[model samples]
Target: MTTPPRPWPGLFISFEGIDGSGKSTQARQLYESLRSGGHDPLLTREPGGSPGAEEIRALVLQGDPDRWSAETELLLFTAARRDHMERAILPALQAGRTVICDRFADSTRMYQGRGGLRDKVDALHDLMIGIDPDLTLLIDMPAEAGLARAKSRATDEERFEDFGLDLQQRMRDGFLALAAAAPARFRVIDGNRDMDSVARDVHATVLRELAPSS
Candidate 1:
């Protein structure tokens, strides 16, 4: 299960899902919604939030899928996250700014915590970067539909997506399991519907989280 974030005044929100689950779009939508509501929210993404992290992003995301071993990839990702937290996320939260991140440690838990490396992943996370978003919105949809959507406009970062449908299915199941384990921290949103409908749910869920004192 995920733990609460450090006691910061800012609300930390993260969007999670399998590739092409529309999580990135929803994250952006929520950021826009918060801005429109007169809240100062910082929009960011994992594996590349700070300049140092962005450098590692290309190294892991591009090139052949077999370019780096899963263990190496894990270290690279964790390093990027550490830099991102130090340079961007932590400071924003410290300033009492809502940090809206497209992805976070959960992505590492999914993407790299495979092939029996979950224990290592968790251990490293606890040792190096020990924080999770207060709330994570998981955009859920069928794996087939999501893979199809992901491949439509695939780019060089397509290394992960290129794993094809089987991996996508496993990732979807893994994500759902993660959500089930941490119900209080996760809001599972259906992403198979139209974009507007999905955005409405995302917006409403976030509003409830912010209602306590925003």
Candidate 2:
């Protein structure tokens, strides 16, 4: 079991899914919706939210897909995440601002675990970054659909997306398993729908979390 972080006054939400599941789009939409509704929300992304982390992002996302061994990549990601937490996430939460992150440790668990480093990834996360999001929205979809979508984007950040369809299917399954393991914090949303429909579900989920408990 993963240890939770100390209690925080602000809300922290994260999005997780296979590459190209439209999780990023939904996260941005939620941020926009929150701002329009007069809420102060900080939108950020993993491995690159803070200045130092962004540098690490290029190192991880660029280069040959096999540039780093699984263990080495995990270390780099952990270092980046630590910097992100210290510089960006922690401070925002301390100020009582909602932080919507595009991806978090779950991505590491899924991606690295695929390379037979599941135990190492979990241990590193528990030791260095025990913080879990208040809510994680998993955008569920078929791997093929997601891969098609991701390939169309054609960004230089193709290291992960280029892993092919088989890996993506495994990742999709891995994310669902993680959600099943932690049902309370994970909301599995159907990502096969239209953008507006998916955004509606994401928006509703965040609103419920933000609502005052009666």
Candidate 3:
């Protein structure tokens, strides 16, 4: 007799947003909560998941314009992601752990494709869709407000962070469009509210989708 299909035990969740959108904070909190509830959840960030990816992250986040370009930025991100998936994320998922990524392909789609270089965003997005997240939580906030929050935390900015407000606005719009297009996979959380409220919303969404084992 033919065997029935086995249930997919693992889940993949991704957090995405512009800088200062509070994604990292919520991601960590969710990770802790999931672990406390007896679930195997691995918390990781994009551009820096594996050892090799971490080095690439340093180059991407710590460079000046002279050392970085739009194409270079996009390719470096892809390289890190490829390694991370091979070494970290895919294995975790296969082992029945919830893989929570702070950022994923969406960031490149927003930052490099939409905000910086509009020509290659589609191809990049397609590359990511090949191995997509089971659930993607998009923390949405105003570009200006996010920038203000970002500046308060750091006196300096990175190469990508130095982009103009107009570009940031475009990135926000791009994220919104993505969420609208993928209602099943993307949850758009209103991040203009306080941090606790945002986390609550994100947590609620996760519970609804994952129903975390007791």
Candidate 4:
């Protein structure tokens, strides 16, 4: 059992995109930039932020595609998120620190919900993890290009990427649709350019979002 988190006065920023979309890179850059500019920012990732959640991340990420059923994976992801919220995210946010997460519930919604379990995913999130990011930065690009970048990566966490180009394309489309539905909280950035340009757009967008609170 864990102690409940206090209300977060700070901002909660999440980055979402398909594999190889460069969200991770942009997220890190934002964290570093904020830190250098004298801001209190906490950088974290989904499925693996807190200690317990990190352990679960290995289980879900490094296994065969069919190792866990969609339902089971949903449960596992929710549990990990619950733990991460309790241990890592809420604490920093309570301290008025910006929490920049690499991924969040949106990822779960898109990845696990790609199948027929979208309703279940939302229900579980509402029940077990009832919070959403204040802002979500979506790195958008062509599916084939993103898939190629993802395939070039030499990591064991290729379970999702192994699903092939069709799934990647679908995921990209789903992400775009999600952004469209929530224009206020979602900022879509073109990711086909050089890393520096993408990072610049991400930084400027985040600055604009944070201006009100800053």
Top lDDT model: 2
Candidate order, TM-score descending:
2, 1, 4, 3
Q: Over the stretch 56-144, how does candidate 2's per-residue lDDT look in tens digits? A: 99999987889998889999999999999999999998898999999999999999767678999999999999898999999999999
Q: How close is candidate 4 to the true structure, as a TM-score?
A: 0.94
Candidate 1 structure quality by residue, lDDT tens digits, 13-90? 999999999999999998899999999999999879999999999999898889999999999999999999999998
Q: Tell me the lDDT of model 1 at 74.
A: 97
| Model 4 accuracy (lDDT, Cα) | 0.91
lDDT of 4 by residue, 38-123 (tens): 99899999989999999999999987889999998999999999999999998888889999999999999999987799999999
Error of 2 at 27 (Å): 0.7
Stretches off by above 4 angstroms in model 2 are: 1-6
Candidate RMSDs in order: 2.7, 2.9, 4.0, 4.8
Query: How do these models rank on lDDT, best leading?
Result: 2, 1, 4, 3
